[model samples]
Target chain A: MSLLSLQSVTKTYGQGQAAFQALAGVDLAVEAGDFVAVMGPSGSGKSTVMNILGCLDTPSSGSYLFQDVHVENLDRNQRALLRRHYLGFVFQGFNLLARTSALENVELPLLYRGEPVAARHAAARAALEQVGLAGWETHNPAELSGGQQQRVAIARAIVTRPTVLLADEPTGNLDTRRSHEIMELLTRLNLELGITVLMVTHEPDMAAYARRVVHFVDGRVDSDQRNTPRETPA
Target chain B: MIWNTLLIALREIRRNLLRAFLTILGIVIGVLAVVTMVTLGNGATQAVSAQVASLGSNLLMVMPGQRLGPGRDSAGAPSFKLADAEAIRAQIPGLAGVAPMASSQVTVVAGGQNWSTTIQGSSRDWFHAGAWKLASGRLFNEGEERAGAAVCVVGERVRKELFGKQDPVGSQIRVKQFVCDVVGLLQAKGQSGMGRDQDDVVVMPLRTVQRRLTGSQDVAGLMISVRDGVSTSKVQQQLEGLLRERRHIADLEQDNFNVMDTRQIAETLSGTTQVLTALLGAVAAVSLLVGGIGIMNIMLVSVTERTREIGIRLAIGALEQEVLLQFLIEAVVLSSLGGLIGILLATGLSMVLADLMQVPYAFDPGINLLAFGFSAAIGVIFGYFPARRAARLDPIEALRHE
Candidate 1:
């Protein structure tokens, strides 16, 4: 069974004459240990799909299953619990809590999970180290460069050891060098930990890092293809 | 869970310390006003009761003419004489003492100093009836009272004014034209319930007051002290009947004499103080409501100011209740801090004002606890709306907020 599946998902905003459909009759499946990149123009509804996949929103009409459980049928709190245990999200803005240290930011998910202090500390520290921020635990988002801040956001996302990592333009605010560095880190996480990743990006070069790419046009999938992943520069 | 929420709340408060302090300022002033007014008012009530008790706990005063209110007396009421006091002492059962009293304001000269003070005349039983204690010397003997000798007992204020630090006992002070020897010194009694100076007079034989001072045989009033365990109301009723019969008032006529119970006076005075205290407290409580609104105002601003942060929290699997609790706890912390500081401020302020106002310092734990609890409740009452608003925000829309 696929790790995550969405069948005929349709999302609409407003009503009657003013109605706008962001996603219509879209079907997608993500299996375990897969790295898929979703790419599209600004108004092609890729962000809406990402929001639904991250469990931050529910499809207006669709059947969504995660690990055989109906995602569309879950209430708000239940969806929160699912996201807590099985999913992690990285945002385009590198959404680390301002004025908070990197370690505390990473520990937020575990804090909500009600983990013991010592265990949460240990997990958060290890996640930060995995993102090459071992000695920067106490640095706040304002004090860090864009690349370092994005690394902290990634550490926060994976602190819970979620089954899937969702990145929405994770390096959108960084320069080319930092963006390459983030892509390499993401690829390494997917290959070494066998964690599935679903990323949304507008950069073709960034999409080249994914083993499978899906292009969204209007509100439906225009093309889906597979390719050999590009090698990272030493 | 609670610990985590508290930590987050404290962190949020620390982030904007000035704003937090400003937010709780209303609560602080509200609690302070309520506590200070109540505490000082309690002290004043206690002082009034104590002064009344000092006038003799079971004492009764028979005054000519009915007292309509404070300072308003009925006209054409006949004065009591020595015979009236003698009759009450003979007829009344369970009586401690009864003394006929007459008083006049006169100038008394001693050594090189002359002081104008109230001069009172009564029998030796006056000491017992009025609960007067002697600080020095002794009361007049029966021979002196019966002969109407030129002997007097000086009160503390009279001695201080006319004799300075010198002993006034055995010293001759000229009262108007008569040279009277000071036989005793009365103890200080401070102020009376009516705020009059109690220790500012001279006491002498009633006969001397009637013949030498006023040249009249009538006494102004009678002071009666009841024995222990005797009901004052019962004695009052018996005195009313006996005086009415003695004065020969008709069955339908209003009695010319008024009987005043000291205990009743104490209760009435203290009751007035308590009502005033409650009024001031109610007025102060309005500020607490204003403080609650202040909390709501700041919390609403805080929710809006931290929208992106809230979005991040929501995206990271924080339950709606968690976000709600975080903001709610922040508000509660702010207002409770205000309450605690207000309590401390009131304690210090009440003590200082009580000393200045010449009343006892009374610390009532119940009022303090109530004010503190009420301030916290104000926080919760006003904090919930903003918290609910923050929790119900859509994560996607919130993240997009600039």
Candidate 2:
């Protein structure tokens, strides 16, 4: 069975004359350990798809199944539990808590999971190390550079060992070199840990790192293609 | 969950210490006003009661004329004579003592020091009726009281004013035109229930006062003490009837004399102070409501400012209740801290003010705890709306907030 399946999912805002549809009957499926990049222009509903897939939003119509559990029927709290156990998110803004240290930000998910202090500490430290920030655990987001802050955000996203890592334009704020570095980190996480990755991007170079690219236009998929993923330049 | 929320709250408060203090300022002032007013008022009531009690328990005072409104009668009522005191002492049952008293303001001089003080004259029974203790020397003998001896006792304040630290028992002091020997010194009784100094007087035999000062064979009032377990109201009734009959009041006429019970006076005076205390407390409590509004105001601001942070928390698997709990705990901590600081401030201020006002220091634990608990309740009552607002934010829209 596929790890995630969305069939004819639609999301609309407002009502009647003011109603706006962000997504209109989109179908997608992700197998385990897949690295898929979703590409589109602005207002093309790429972010909407990411939101629905991350369980931060539900479809106005149709079915969403995660491990065959029918996620579309879950209530708010149940969706939260699903997200807590199975998903991780990295944002374009590098949304690390402003005044909090890197290690504490990474430990946030495990804290919500009610992990014991010692175990959470060990897990968060390891996740930071995985993102190449071992000795920078004590630095706050404000004290770190933009690229380093994004690393902390990724560390926080992966600390829970989520089955699927959702990156919503994660490298949209970085320079070329830093963007390549982040793409390399995401690629390594997907290949080494067998974690599924579903990313949204506007940049073709970033999309090239994924094994599959799905192009969205006007709330519908324009093209879906498979390619040999490019290895990171050392 | 509660522990985690509390931790987050403390961290937030520490982050913006000034804002937190300013947010809770209203609560601090509210609690301080309530506690200080109540505590000082309690001390005043206790002082009033203590002074009234020192006048003697189960005692009654019979004064000429009715105590009308704020003024005494314009037509003078007939005064009591020595014979009336003898009649009450001889005829009444359950009676401890009866003494007719008359007083005048006089300047007394001794050893080149002159001081103006009240001079009261009565029989030896006056001391027993007033429960007055003598510090030195002796009260006048029966012969002196009967013969109208020129002997007197000075109160503590009088002694201090005229003689400094020297003993005045053997000294002679001139009262108006009469030269009198200081036979004894009365112990200090501090202030009266009316806030008048009780120990600024001299005492002599009633005959001496009537003959040498006023030159009339009449007394101003009668002090009557009843034995323990005797009902003061019952004695008051008997005294009223006897004095009315003696003064020739008809059946239709109001009694020419008024009977005042000291115990009832104490209760009435203390009750008035208590009511005033409660009024002050209630007025102070209004400020606490204002304080709660302040908390709500600041919490709303906090929710708006942290909109994006809340969105992140929600997206990262924080339950709605968790967000609500976080903001709610922040408000509670702020108000509770205000309560704690208010208590400490009130305690210190109350002690200092009570001392300056010459009243006892009365610490009521119940009022302190009540103020504390009420402040915390204010936080919950006012904090809920903002906290719920924070919890109900749309995660997608919130993340889009600038």
Candidate 3:
């Protein structure tokens, strides 16, 4: 059984006349440590698939197996537990709580887990340092530049040391140089921490950082291919 | 988890201090108004009770005609005589004492100092019926009462005004057309329930005022005291019947005289004040509901404002209840803080108002605690809908919200 797999997954939105199908029987699978970049146009089923994989939304029909467990059968709270224990998400907008210090923002997940104050503080500090924000713990998101804010967002995501790191256009808001830097950090985390990385990006340059790239067209996987050089250039 | 949620709530409130304060302003004012009205009302009731208690134990006052109103107060009713008081003493059983009294406003002069005061005329039983005690000197003898003696007892206020600190006993005071010898000084009985000063009067034998002051042989009122362990009501019923027969009232006609039960008057007065207090308190409580609505309004706005933030949290794997608790606790903290401040302000305000209104400052812990608990309850009640809205958001749609 793969670490995460979706077989014949389909999703529908609205009802009756407004009922629009976003996913049309897509099949995908990932091993524990693989880095896959999902590529598609705006209307393709990439985002719908990502939402299903992240457990934020349920598929209308199909079997979503996380470690061979049927994620589709899990209730909202159970899916939340799965996401809590195993998934980390990074967004393009870099959503950080406003008027809050980086350390406290990073501590949010640990807080939900009912960790003690001392443990949450220590773990949050370590995560901040890991994201190259060691001395920026006291600074709020407003005080940080866009790249720094994204780093804080990444730190918050990985604070729980999740099994799967999902990035949704992680560097879409950044310039080329900053985007390259963020891609490198994600690649390093996949290689060193052995965390599975699933990302959706429109940019080919960012997708090049992934080991495999899956292309979606009209809500189905059109092409899936491995890069020629599996190792990222230093 | 609750503690963490509470901390998060506090942080959120602190982040928007002015908005939070304004949100809870309604609660503070409601609690303040409620506590103030109830506290002051209780104080006034206590003052009334205390004043009436000082009149005498188991005492009843009988005046000619009905009580004070548009059509009554001794109008067109033949007044009592000294004989009526004698008849009550002779006929009534379980009687303690009966004193027939007549009074007129008079100006008196002593040692060249003049003061206007009320002059009361009654037999020696007046002292016994009222349970009055002398600060100095003695009551007049029976012979003096029969011969219409010019000897009198002065109250503290009259003594103070007429002779300063000097001993009024053995001194002479001129009242109307005759000079009377001051024989005793009565101890002060401060203010009465009617807000009249009880210590601003002079008392003399009933015949002296009838002859020398008013030139009438009529008595204006009767003060009757019942002995301990005796039913004042039963005695009151018999007295009413006897007065009706003596005054020649037929079976269907209302009696010319009205009797005032001190105990009944105390209850009625306090009952009226309590009703007023309850009314004001209930009105104030409605404002508390309004305050809760204010909290709900702000919380709804907050949930909408933080839609993206909630989406981020949900995306990061926070449970739905966690989000709900954060907002719920935020509202609870705001209103509870308001309750605390309101309690403090109410205490200070009621103390000042009580003094200005001449009532005792009554601090009620039960009310303060109830207000606090109620405000917290209001938070839970009003905060739920908004918190639920925040918790039940579609993470994807919420993330897309601007």
Candidate 4:
């Protein structure tokens, strides 16, 4: 069975004659350990797809199944619960809170899980170590380099051991070398942790890092293709 | 969970040190003013109550004036004669003792060291009515009042000023250059309602004071102590009626005499001071509201400034309630700190004022707790809007915030 499946999902903003459609009739499925990339032009609805999958936005009409449990109809609080237990997110800006230590940033997800301090710290440190940030645990976001900050963000995303890691233009703000480093880190996390990854990017080079690429042109998918090679140098 | 929220709040405050300090400063000043005003009010009330209680409970002062006249201004009006006191004592039922007192400020000389001092002439009951106690020797005999003897009793303050530590019971003090033997010394009574030194006077027979010092045959005021089981209100009514009948206030015109109870006056003054304190405290409480506005202002800024942080938290699965709790806790922490500092500042301010006013220090724990609770409430009242706004922010939009 697919780990995540969506059918006829639609998202609209505003109402009546002035309505704007961001997503329409979207259907997709992903199995465990799959590294998928979504590419699109501006306003192509790839970002909206990522938002829905990350549980940050709900489709106006949809059937979304995570581990075979329909979640599109769940309320906000239930969505929060689903996100905490099942998903992780990484953003382009490396949104690690300014002035917070890397370990604390990594421990953010478990904070909602109501875990004990010792358990939270243990999980956070292990996640940071997996991202090669063990020595910089006490460093704040401002003090770290962009690549390191994104690593911390990645560490935070995976600390709760979510089933899927959603990276939205995760390397959009980095240079070529730093971008490749981040992509390598994400690939390693997917391969080693057996966690699925769905990433949104416009760069063909970045999309080449994923096992599959789904391209969107407007509010709908234009092509979906399995990658011949999953390694790319940015 | 509360502890965790508190930790996050404290850290966030520390992250924005200057803003937090400025926000708390408003509450600090407000709460400090509140506590100081209340303490001063309480101290003044206490001082007046103590002074009033020292004059014996349920005592009345009957003076000659328009019956409906103001009591404070009635002091310098026409004086009551010794006959009037005798008349009231004989005619009135539920009668205790009415002591007619006559007073004049005169120069007193003892061993060539002269100073101006007050002299009072009174009958024997004046001792009980005025709550005066003799430190040495004894009170006068009733024969002295009738015969207008030259014998006298000097106060402790007068004795100390004239003879230092020496025994003043047998001393002779020259009043208006007339030698009068002091048969007793009055105990220290400190200051009185009129802010005069009560112990800086000599007491003589009513006739002696009337004839020798002032050359007037009338008394200054009458001290009437009501008998047990008789209320001052009833006595006041009876005295007013009798005085009106005797003084002949025919019709329509206010009777030219007044009777006042010391306890009643003290209570009225106490009540007035309490109201004034509360009014002033209310003014100070407005500042607490302003302080709450300050918290609100800062919280709004914090919510805006940390919008992306909120998004990250929401994205990581924080409930809206948790976000609200974090901001609310931050505001409460700031206000509570301000309250503590305000309490300390008030203590210092009240102590200094009490010493300057020569009043007793009044520090009540209940008032302190009340101030603290007020500050905390201000935090919650002012913090809720901003917190709710933050909690309702869409995570996607918040994440996109620059």
Candidate 5:
């Protein structure tokens, strides 16, 4: 069975006169430990696909299966549980809570999981260190550079040791050097921890870090290709 | 869960100290006004009741008029004489004591010091009927009272003004044209419920005030005390009937004199204070309601302001209730803290005002608890809609929100 699969899912926004279809009959499957990148134009529904996979949203029609369980039928709380236990998200904005320290930001997922403070602290510390931020644990987002803040966001995403990491435009706000550094971190996390990394990037160079790339056009997938990734940054 | 929510609430409050302080100030002023009004109201009521009670339990004042109050026009009615008091003492079966009371406002001079005070004239029975006790010395001797002698008992206020610290009991004071020796010092009873000074007086023999001061045989009023275990209302009815018969009032005509019950007077006076307190408390309640609306307004803006934060939390895995509880508890903690501060402030303010008004400082625990409970309820009521708005936001749309 596939790690996660979407079977001919269709999603529409609005109603009647102003209705707009964001996704039309999209079929996708992701294997465990695979790094797949989704690329599309601005209005091609790539982020919608990410939202559905992250369980922050559900498709308007058709089945979403995770490990042979139908995700479409899950209630809101159940979906939240799925997201909490199995998924992590990285947004373009690096949505770390303002004025919160890096370590505490990483500890947020564990806090929702109701873990003990000592364990959460230890795990958050390890996750921050894994993101190459061992001594920057106490720095708040405003105090950190954009690259460091994005790194903190990535650390926060992986702190729970999630099965799949969904990153949408993770390097969108960073310059080339910072973007390459974040992609390298993602590559290392995917290869070493065997986490399924599903990313959406507008930049071809950022997408080159993924082993597989899927391109979308006009709200539907137009191409899917596999390649040997550029493992080292220029 | 509660502890974590409380932590989040405290952090939010600390992060936005100025906004929180503004919200809290609204509640503080509201609660402070409410508590102070209630506390002081209760104190004034208690003071009134005490002052009325000090006039002697089950006491009645028979004023020589059909009408009562500020514009009491008693000129059309004949004043009561000492014979009326004697008649009431003889005819009323449940009587404890009676005094024929007459008074004249006079300037009393002692040594070089002079003070203007009321000189009340009545028999020795006036002590029991008017609830007067000797703080020092003694009441009139048989010769002094029976012969209408030139002797008097000076109340504490009159003594203070006329004789300073030296004992007035052995001193002489000039009333009108004649000098009278002070044979006793009456204990101080402070002020009456009507704001009249009870102790600012000199008590002389009835005939001395009638002959030497007023030059009349007429008494101003009758002071009567009912015996213990007797129903004062029943005695009042009997006293009324006896006076009607003595005054020769026709069966169809209204009686010339009016009977005033101390207990009834206490109820009326306290009722006035209670009404005033209710008015003030109502004003305060409106203020609290407005303060609650202010909280709602702030929370609404806060929910809007922190949409992105909420999006982040929801994305990470905060349940709807978690987000809801965070905001709700924040408002609760802020308002409740405001209530606590207001109660403390009200306590201090009420005490000071009570002292200034010369009323007892009465602390009511129920009111304090009720005020606290009300503020917390305000939190839950006003905090709900904004919290619900926060919880119901779409995570994707919220994330996209700038």
Candidate 6:
């Protein structure tokens, strides 16, 4: 069974003639240990798809089965539970809480799980170390380099040992070298940790690193293809 | 779960230290003012009540008419005299003691130091009637009062002014032009019910004051002290009848005097003070209400400012009740802390005022506790709406907020 699946999901905003469709009958599925990249142009509804997949938003009409449970029917609290227990998210903006150290930001997911501070701290340290950010736990997001902040974001996403890791333009704010470095880290985490990764990116070069590429246009998937050579050392 | 939320709240408050301080400041000042006002009011009431009680209960004072009667005003009005006091004492059945006194405010000189003081001359019974107590030496003797001797007893304030803690016993102080020997120092009487310092004076023999100070044979007022468990009104009636018979006043004519009872005066004064304090407290309470409103304003602002934070917590599986609880607690803490500070400051201020007014310093635990409870109540009352607003915020919309 797929770890995360969206079956004909659609999201609409407003009403009557003024109504807009942000996601239109989108269908996608991500299995365990799969690295899927969603590619799209501006206004192509890739962000809308990401929002739905992460459970940060709900579809107007659809059947979303997360671990065989229908996510589209889940209540707000249930969705929060799914997000806490199974899914993790990394944003392009390195959405670490301002004024918080990297270690504290990484500890956020554990806070949602109601873990004790000591246990949360230990898990956060382990996650940061996995991202090659050992000993940089005390540094704030603002103090770190672009790639380092992205690494911290990635660490926060996987701190809870979630089954799926979702990244929305993970390297959009980084330089080419830093972007490649972050992609390398994500690829390593997917391969070594066996965590499914579903990422959104506009760059073809970045998409090439994924085992599968799903192209979205006008709120629907235009094409889906498998990469010929997905394994490449950074 | 509670610990986490509290930790987060404390952290946020620390981060926004300036805002937190500003918010708490309103509560602090409000609580402080309320506590201080209540404490001072309690202290004042206690001091006045004590002084009134000390002057004796169910006691009546018969003062002379403002206008000279009988010989000057109406042909029927009788005059107040020392002889009237004697007649009242002899005729009244329920009477305990009766003492007539002549009083005047005059300059008292001891060596080069001269101080203005009220001088009262009375018999031996005057000590019990007016509640005067001697600190050193002895009270006036029948020998001194009968012989109209020149010996006198000075009050604490008068002794302090002239002698500067030195013993004034065996020393002589001049009352007007006549030198009177100070045989004793009176006890510190503190402030009287009417806000006057009861200790700033000297007491001499009634005959001596009549002879030397006024150069008149008549007394100014007659004080009748009623015995405990006796009906004061009955004694007053008997005294009035006797005075009329002694002075030969005709029927259908107004008596040339007013008999004032200390207990009645105390009740009237106490009621008046209570009304005044309540009015002052009501005014102060308005500020507390305003402080509660201030707390509400700050709390509302806090909800708005921390909307995103609320969203984050909600998204992470926090209950609406939890969010509401957090904000409400913050408000209560702020206001209650303000109340505590106000109470402390009021205690200090009340003591200082008591010293300045020459009254007994008093601290009432009940009033302090009431003020503190009032502050916390204000917090809860004002904090509700803001906390509700925070709890009702949509997590999705809040997350999207800037």
Candidate whose TM-score is highest: 5
- Please, what are the lDDT tens digits per residue for candidate 5 over residues A24-53? 989999999999999999999999999998
lDDT of 6 by residue, B75-142 (tens): 43444677777777776767778888888889999978989999988887788887877788887788
TM-score order of candidates, top first: 5, 2, 6, 1, 3, 4
The residue-by-residue lDDT of candidate 3 on A61-120, one tens digit each, is: 989999989998987678877878899888889888888899989998888778899999
Which candidate's lDDT is highest?
A: 1
Better candidate by lDDT, 2 or 4:
2
Higher-TM-score candidate of 2 and 4: 2
lDDT tens digits, residue span B230-343, model 3: 888898899899999899999998778988877887877778778877887788778776766776666666666578877877888777888888877877777778888999
DockQ of 5: 0.54
Residue pairs of candidate 1 with colliding backbone atoms: none
Error of 5 at B177 (Å): 3.4
Considering only the true interface residues, what is the Cα RMSD of candidate 5 after superposition?
1.4
Tens digit of per-residue lDDT, candidate 5, span B1-402: 677666666776786788788778777777787788889889988998888788877888898888577766666788998888888888888888898989999999998899999999998888988788899989886677668889999999988887788788888999878989889999889998888998999999998889899899999988888888999999989988988888899999877889989888888898988898788878878877787777667766666557787788889887778777887787778888888898999999999999999899999898787777776677666666655765677677677666
Query: Compared with the true structure, what per-residue lDDT tens digits does model 1 show for residues B306-401?
Result: 777778888889888888888778777887888888898989999999999999999988888887788778776666675576567767767777
- Pull out the clashing pairs in model 4: B65-B256, B65-B257, B66-B256, B66-B257, B67-B255, B67-B257
True contacts kept of 3: 0.65
The C-alpha stretches of model 2 lying farther than 4 A from their native spots are: A174-177, A226-231, B1-29, B68-74, B109-114, B177-179, B323-358, B363-365, B392-394, B397-402
Instruction: Give RMSD to native, each candidate.
Output: 3.7, 3.1, 3.9, 4.0, 2.9, 4.1
- Cα error of candidate 6 at position B136, Å: 2.7
State the lDDT of candidate 4 residue by residue for B1-402, as single tens digits. Answer: 777777777778887788779777877777787888788878877887787788888688987765442553444456677778989899887766899988998889898788788898998888888788888898878888788998899988889888889888888988885889889988898876547788998889999988898898877788999887898899889888887777777778665777888887787767877787788778877876676677667766666667777888888898888888887787777878888888998899999998998777899787788877877777666666755765676689788766
Instruction: Give lDDT for model 6.
Output: 0.79
- Pick by TM-score: 2 or 3, better one: 2
lDDT by residue (tens digit), candidate 2, A124-151: 9999999999999989898998899999
For model 6, what is the alpha-carbon lDDT of residue A60? Answer: 94
Error of 1 at A232 (Å): 3.5
Q: Once superposed on the true structure, which residue ranges of model 6 sit more than 4 Å away at CA?
A: A14-20, A39-43, A116-118, A145-147, A203-205, A227-234, B2-26, B65-79, B243-256, B290-294, B316-370, B377-394
* Deviation of model 1 at B387, angstroms: 2.5
Mind listing the fnat for each candidate? Answer: 0.65, 0.48, 0.65, 0.67, 0.48, 0.21
Q: Compose the digit string of candidate 6's lDDT tens values, residues A1-234.
A: 888889989989889999999888988888889999999999899988887888877889988898899988887767777877887878777666666789987887687577998999999999999999999998977799989988998998898888888899999999999988888888988888898999999998899889999999999999999885456675
